[model samples]
Target: MTRIRLLTVAWLVLFPLAGLADYLEVRRETAVYKEPSKKSEKLVTVDPAERSPYLLKLASGAKTKGYYQVNLPGANEKGWIYQSYVRRYKGQHPGYVAYKRTFYKHWIDEDGDCQDTRQEVLIRDADAKVAYQDEDHCKVEASAWKDPYTGKTFTNPKDLDVDHVVPLKNAHESGAWTWSAERKKQYANYLQYEKHLLAVSASENRKKADKGPDRYMPPNAAYHCEYVRIWTKIKRDWELEMTEAEGEKVQQILENCN
Candidate 1:
């Protein structure tokens, strides 16, 4: 088994492909897999104490969705590692703090579509025809969005904020503090589901900033059930924990949901 793994690693090293950039430090110890999928064979374990590994960005058969192709240290082995367990290393250690806006970078255009995650959400959730600022259709100039929290309507994009239903700080406190920087970015700019991010009135979002259901609920009582529903869903999707008060409040709100 070990000989076969060594042969595979040697093949990759002999014919290195292109687009291999970025060094990633293991935030937590995790296994290196023969393929990108977790169901694939596990070849080796990466420890946090070892020097950071290099992430191959675009090598042929190297990178896959949500995983990075890496060359392990002290061996000739190459395997795919889950991106969540590693961070792009810049000489800084991994750590997160509550309400730390500086730690997460939102509005990333991971798809290379010129339109960032923020603009994409604004365009998607708009109730009316969205106006584009440029020919590329990347920037959203104006749009009408209804705030679920305040029941307010705004035609200007500036009036609305793309709110993380489970705010960054809240997630950090719950369990994200242990996550790598890459994982935090994924949570902040998550576009997998509409409920994860919402277009809401800026003022209302500020009022509810980083507060869980225990301490805060939307001012628009009619939307309380939906708000809590989205909140609970986000927490569950990310495997976050809820405080006793938060759990009780969410349960109460759910009971009132029609």
Candidate 2:
């Protein structure tokens, strides 16, 4: 049996095979974006080394500016991967590693109860019972959270972001790009490990976006040692690659810790 790798927009423009094929396959490492452009929020990357090539499906027959809407491999929602990255899977289609992953699973609703990972994190990190936005309790309206990165205490959920301690892009550069989509998702939303995701002020999180320890550190100097510890532990635990500079910086921070 032959696999139809992709039902890309270009293919549809030529063949127009609507509903004939549903699944999409990846040729190499590529990102599935939240929108049909490169600048949009990245959702995840599909890599050939991690799993089967059939990593996506046509979510709909939608097309826009050379992008095709596709269902993420391990998720229910749709994301966009560029048309050039996809091809009709006649058999043995080859592609280069045009993109390295900087995306990961967002706050997912693992139990499908409407509350997502973000809500769960907010609730857990809150010092008290969280207030809900609505009667259904689907959203957290208010919560007391201390932003370790900025040393500011916040009571509004909108003011905080559940930051990835090891930013997804940094993780990708640290060798997470080689992982399977499922593995990447697991790393992204992992909660078992302490401080993997921290509720920090949105401003600080933005300031720290995708930067490693060498480039970015918490503004709250008091949290510096703990920050380095968590960073190093995550790098060590995940077996992620580290630059010599990063290692040196981490060591410097650790030496000053009590």
Candidate 3:
């Protein structure tokens, strides 16, 4: 709670990681501008490479609206980079444990309409209309959903599992283990972004459990780029760190994207 400030607006997802970072890491191809604005002269590029993440140290805690005052990696001098282009970084975080029956993890019904996040995704992703468990449509029973992971179609809701594109376990290891329970709850049931959660085959989700693109990807080769893109976007948006292997894999796919 001390590190986070909640905004009063709707869709207020605070992007700060629960843990404090000792250094700043470039998220993508970031330019070190001579000043805080883009119109300022570009000093150099700070991009992540196979073995390097392009770390920066703060010259001072000075603020400039939407930029960080940091020292360029080797030059050790003041430069400015956009806030969104860099992420706070610490070293390796071990994230391989399986999930537990946590208090907040039960399917969330944010709208108090009884159709929990799971049901909502089922309904939203349906190729056509969906049936419900009750007259009020509180629970989705069946829907025609096309599984992007396997590129297969399923009509029964039981055949699908709503998946977190960046799996919870992976998130915990990356930076979310420090997240407040409420934040974890929000992420577990988040529906703000369509690609954040997907309705894919149950078996496909199980088979690809707790692994990154470096270790596993959707069986549908056609889905590789989209999968990587979603994975990268989710990681960047959440300010989560990718493991070396994971980072390399994502970078490779992104470099080849057309």
lDDT score for candidate 3 against the true structure: 0.70
lDDT of 3 by residue, 139-238 (tens): 8877689999999999988889999999888777565554556777888888888999999999999998889888998999889999998887777555
Winner on lDDT between 1 and 3 is 3
Best by lDDT: 3
The Cα local distance difference test for each model comes to 0.69, 0.69, 0.70
Candidate 1 structure quality by residue, lDDT tens digits, 1-258? 011123232211211211123346566778878888899988876565432232222223334888887754323356788878876543222432344776788879999999998898899899999899999999999878888899989988888899998888877766566567787888889888888999888988999888888899989999898888788767755545565578778877887778
The TM-score between candidate 3 and the true structure equals 0.66
Angstrom error of the Cα, residue 230, model 2: value is 0.5
lDDT of 2 by residue, 98-209 (tens): 2344457677888887888888788888986789999989999987888888888999899999888988887765545546677787887787885988888998899998
Clashing pairs in 2: 5-89
lDDT of 1 at 157: 85
Candidate topping TM-score = 3
Candidate 3, residue 135: the lDDT equals: 98
Against the true structure, candidate 2 reaches a TM-score of: 0.62
Clashing pairs in 1: none
After TM-score superposition, the amount by which residue 117's alpha carbon in candidate 1 deviates from its true location, in angstroms, is: 1.1
